[model samples]
Target: MCPRRARCFNTTGPCSPQHHYMLPPAQRLPEARELIEMDRYFVLHAPRQTGKTTPP
Candidate 1:
């Protein structure tokens, strides 16, 4: 078997668990579920370079 590769922070495109170190998207907005369940509309806002455009 091949040796495990090292992971690094992802700077572009979607991140992969095998190649990048990242927090799960869900953890970033835990309240989103509650808002959705209540039938409320909400917007996501964050500082630049915070992975806002990255897909969950």
Candidate 2:
């Protein structure tokens, strides 16, 4: 197992709560799971620097 590290601010790439101070991605888009489970097509529209690229 890997040792837990202190969280810090992330300026590039994906942000993980375990290693970076960030809002939970799942909470940002609560409906994503339902939409995905339904197997429907959808688009995520957001400005740059937002967590839009993060995995659902």
Query: Against the true structure, whose lDDT is highest?
Result: 1
- Count clashing residue pairs per candidate: 0, 0
Which residue pairs overlap in candidate 1's backbone?
none
lDDT of 1 by residue, 1-56 (tens): 21469887666788777777778756877998899899998887987676666764
- Model 2's TM-score against the true structure: 0.54
> What TM-score, over all chains together, does every model reach?
0.55, 0.54
Off by over 4 Å in 2: 1-11
lDDT of 1 at 53: 66
Q: To one decimal, what is the Cα RMSD in angstroms of model 1 from the true structure?
A: 4.8
The regions of model 1 sitting more than 4 angstroms off are: 1-4, 34-47
**Candidate 2 lDDT (Cα, 0 to 1):** 0.69
